[model samples]
Structures are given as structure tokens and as C-alpha cells.
Target: MKFLVDAQLPVRLARFLESAGYDTIHTKDLPHKNATSDTEINSISIRDNRIVITKDSDFLNSFLTIKEPYKLLLITTGNINNLELEAIFAANLQFLSELFVSHSYIEMTRDSIIVHY
Candidate 1:
């Protein structure tokens, strides 16, 4: 899977994903440290068939302008501590990987995960 990690995430997550054999890009790698807008990031991901991994709801509105994105992984825990977020994913990586392998939008909420295909 290919992913575009949003600015809210640590860029280190990208390297981790890469080490797992996924194509991953982090916003920090863009031109200037704060150069990207969520819309532009969404557009690039869609145009290139990459899934958007974001904590921002702003991207949920990108559908207003663009017609596609391979998928979206919305982490809805809200300002979760970095270690907590990492631990959650680490505990569920296998399920998450399976979900991503099959769906378009996956919302991971505090109590449940909803996958939209």
C-alpha cells in the first residue's frame, strides 16, 4: 500500500511503513516545512493512487473538490499522545493491514473500527 502521512503524524511513521515494504510519504518531506495544504496533499495522493493517513477532518472534505483517493485512514482518537497512537497501531497492525488491503475508508474510533468500501 502507498500512504501520504499528514502533518499531524511524526514523519518517523513513514520510515516505519517503508521498512514494512509500503510506499510512504510524509508532509515534512515536502518543499517547505509548512508548505502543504490538506487539499493539495489529498489531491496528490488521489492523483498518484496513494491512501491518505490523516488525523485531520479537513481531508474528509477533499471529496468536495476531488473525485478520488485510493483510500483514507482517519485516526479519530483526537490529540492522542504519540506513544499511545503508535502502541494502538502496533497492537492492531495485522488487522489494519488486512483492512487497508480491502477498503477505501477506514475510521478507527475509540471503541470500534468502521471500514467504508
Candidate 2:
């Protein structure tokens, strides 16, 4: 599935996703960059059919409360460097790649991915 990597995540994640063959974009590419509002991000995700990969709990709140984005991959890996974070995603490629097809929300830690509906 396609993905939109939020500002809190390093832009490297977006590059990694693209190299892995999934359509992906980082918030840095948007006009507002880090200042982009959640509402606008949601709108973009909806318009583009992109799942949001974010470290922000606000996205989780929006999803739980009102289902804002098309889907979510909430990174709960906690303050990790880009290389390690990229490693976790790469190692979990099979799961991460297929996750959005059947799940709307997923919490991903360094060790495991938990699907939440």
C-alpha cells in the first residue's frame, strides 16, 4: 500500500519505503513541511489513498475518535535513530507491506506489530 510519512518521522523512512517499491511521500515534500496541520495531512491521505506512518499520538486519537486518515502505522519504537528504525521496518517488510490491506490501525514497536482493527 501507499504511505505518507509524517514529519515526526525522518524523511529517510520515505526514501526507504520508495526503494522498497511502495509509493511513498514524506511531509517534507509538502508546502508546509513540518508545519503541516493534521487536518491537511488527513485530507491528503484521503485524497491519495495513502496510509499514514506517524510517530504522533494525535493521529491515533483522530483515528480512534473519527477515522481521519485512510490507515495508520503508528510507530511506537521510541526515539530511535533513522538507521535502527529503518532496520526494524526493513526486517518487518513482509508484515508492514501487507498490513494496511486488512487493518486500519497498527502499532509498531521495535519487536512487534500490533494490529488494532
Question: Candidate 2, which segments miss by more than 4 Å at Cα?
Answer: none
List candidate 1 stretches off by more than 4 Å.
64-66
Error of 2 at 90 (Å): 0.4
Q: After superposition, how far is residue 82 of candidate 2 from its true place, in Å?
A: 0.9
- RMSD of candidate 2 to true structure, Å: 0.8
The predictions' CA RMSDs to the true structure, in order, are: 2.1, 0.8
Worst 10 residues of 2 by lDDT: 93-102
Worst 10 residues of 1 by lDDT: 61-70
Query: In candidate 1, which residue pairs clash?
Result: none
